[model samples]
Target: MKLSDAAVKKAKPEAKPYKLADGDGMYIEVMPSGSKYWRLKYRYAGKEKRLALGVYPEVSLKDARERRDAARKLIANGTDPGEAKQAQKREGKIAAANTFEAVAREWVENRSNDWTAGHKALTLRTLEQDAFPSIGRRPIAEISSSEVLATVRAIEKRGALEIAGRVLQRCSAVFRYAIATDRCKNNPAFKMSEALKSPTRSHYNTIEKGGFPKLLRDIDGYQGSPMTTYILQLMALTFTRTGELVNAEWKEIDLDRAEWLIPAERMKMRRPHLVPLSVQAVAVFREAAKLSGDRVHVFPNRNDPSQPASNAIILRALGRMGYTGKMTGHGFRSAASTMLNENKSKWGIHRDTIELQLAHVEKNASRAAYNFAEYLDERRTMMQQWADHLDKLKAGAEVVKLRA
Candidate 1:
């Protein structure tokens, strides 16, 4: 007889285990300990097998019969119900293990060899802060393109258009990795670039060539701290990126060789750069060394000698010289590039040499690997001439064009 709720509820345990048959190979097994379990018995491949539906009261009589019907249907389809149940459990475990965050972390670990420590840390930090909180726990295969769009849009709403774009890019990379590894069939983040807002473009404020002489004179006459004064002079001479200049260490400079060898890790392109120091640059370094020779950083912070001086020091000094928004610390690079390129013929230097001296990335990968020292002799000559030109500008002498 098929089981009923009251009949199963009133059914009590006997001296040992007993079965209340519900027909169709389904029964409620009641033990002597007053515990009831729902069980399904079936034959497959000419062999008897048992499947546990669930515990009694929790599974209920109707629920047990429904499970029995489902299992019988599977058996009629020439499939083993017990094996199908096991396969489903395995799939559940796999899905749980292959969440979006899990796959993304694996991808990052695999590619970390090609990235610097700082780059790896930043990539992970952005994922953790922005991407992980939303779809991180979802299975990579189950995440739809719309879900990924929603996650990226959340970042864009906060006015961080650039970070929003970058997060989308990182997610796309992770999805591609998933596709390669067979975790997912398609990339949800594919072709979604147009959905993000475009970031506004801007350039650093810089002075024109005509104003270069006056600016040089103003820096020379400024009565700032000796360290600030020397730092400005060196900045004008080298035209390096502000971070590279401020974080420079005493060990990187060779006064005897007249070179500053900035290591690869500190450079923006992750390539070592050699600055051929001029006679004037050497003098500026000598004056700075008198103040911070014993310290680790050449431009150590005045308040905290252990740390490098803040980049704002240059801007503040420029502001004092009445060039507030007219120029910036990075203006030095723009000024140098402009002046040198315009006077390329007079300076008798190739445009490529000037670009290399500026530490710009070389397009040819194979050549870039060994071109850090390319055109060294020509760059050394150009640097000395450039320094001399600055001296004439500062001295208020007439600007004389060099003979090629």
Candidate 2:
């Protein structure tokens, strides 16, 4: 018999459970405790099975009939509704476990060996701060391209276009990882680069060769912390990245060998780098040793001896030397690269040797392992000659072309 909403409500519970049938294998089972639930009973493979549609009046008469009809259709197609319901429940649990944030975190952890501490932290922080709040709990497989776009666009709206671009890139990587792991089928973050606003590109300020002599002279005469002077001098001599220079440890340097071996963990390319020290560079290191020899870092922070000097020290010193917005610590690399390439023929230095010294070799993992020491002998000579050339310029001597 078809049950009415009023009859289902008015029907009192008996000494035990009783049911009000609504036809087509649908019924509202009323228990002795007065709890009501919607149930569907049907035959599958000649065996009767029951499926819980929902609880009433939440399920109600109308909704229960709809669920019953749907289950019947599944049965007519030779599928068990009870089994299908169980499969759906399992899928829901799996989807909950494989959320976007879950997949992203897994991806980051899987690549931890390849990334530096700072890089890994920055990548995670970017996602947590920008990408996670919106779509983090959603299943990775269900995240659409528009959803990823919206996440990055929110970052761009805050005037962080560069960060927005980076977040998008990381999200794309996370999606790729999900795909590889079978958590997701497609990368929704793919091909969405054109939607982002381009960030303004600015080059580091650097001086030309003609201005090198005066800059060197100014650095030498600068009235500041002796540590600052030495750092500035070393920056010009080594031309290493600022972070690499500031975070240098005493253990990594060998005064006798005239080499500074930066470990793979500290390098930008995740490869160990060997800086062939010249006589002048070694002299500068000696001066630094006198100040911080007992400390861990070669340029330990003045206030915090345990930590390396802040990376901004060089920029602050340059600004004090009246080179504000004109030259930067990184400008040393630009100056050195320009001068070396232009004078390669005259100085008899191989381009490959110069590039190796600059740590600009191919980034293939296997190749990087051995490439750090490639052209060591030529690089050692090149370093010495380059340092000598800088000394000549600093002394206000007339620059002359060297014979090959």
Where is model 1 more than 4 Å wrong at Cα?
Answer: 1-200, 209-214, 315-326, 393-396, 399-404
Error of 1 at 384 (Å): 1.9
Residues 1-404, candidate 2: write the lDDT tens digits.
68998998898988989888889888888899888999988888889889999997777788888888899899989899999999999998888779999889989889888777787898999999999999999998889999998999888889999889999999999998998999989999898989999987544788767889999999989899999999999999999989999999999999899999999999865789999998889989999999999999999999989999999999999999888988998899988998899889998999878888888856567665556778999998888889888888888775553332
Q: Give the TM-score of candidate 2.
A: 0.72
Worst 10 residues of 1 by lDDT: 395-404
RMSD to true structure for each model, in Å: 6.4, 5.8
Model 1, span 1-404: residue lDDT tens: 67889999998999999999999999999999999999999999999999999898989999999999999999999999999999999998898779999999998889776554567788999999999899999999999999999999999999988899999999999999999999999999999999889987334688877788899888878898988888788889999988789999999999988999998877776678899999889988999899999999999998999999998999999999999988898889988988899888997999988999998867887676656778999999999888988988777786554432
Q: What's the true lDDT of residue 99 in model 1?
A: 96
Which structure among the candidates has the greatest lDDT? 1
RMSD of 1: 6.4
Task: Tell me the TM-score of each prediction against the true structure.
Answer: 0.67, 0.72
Worst 10 residues of 2 by lDDT: 395-404
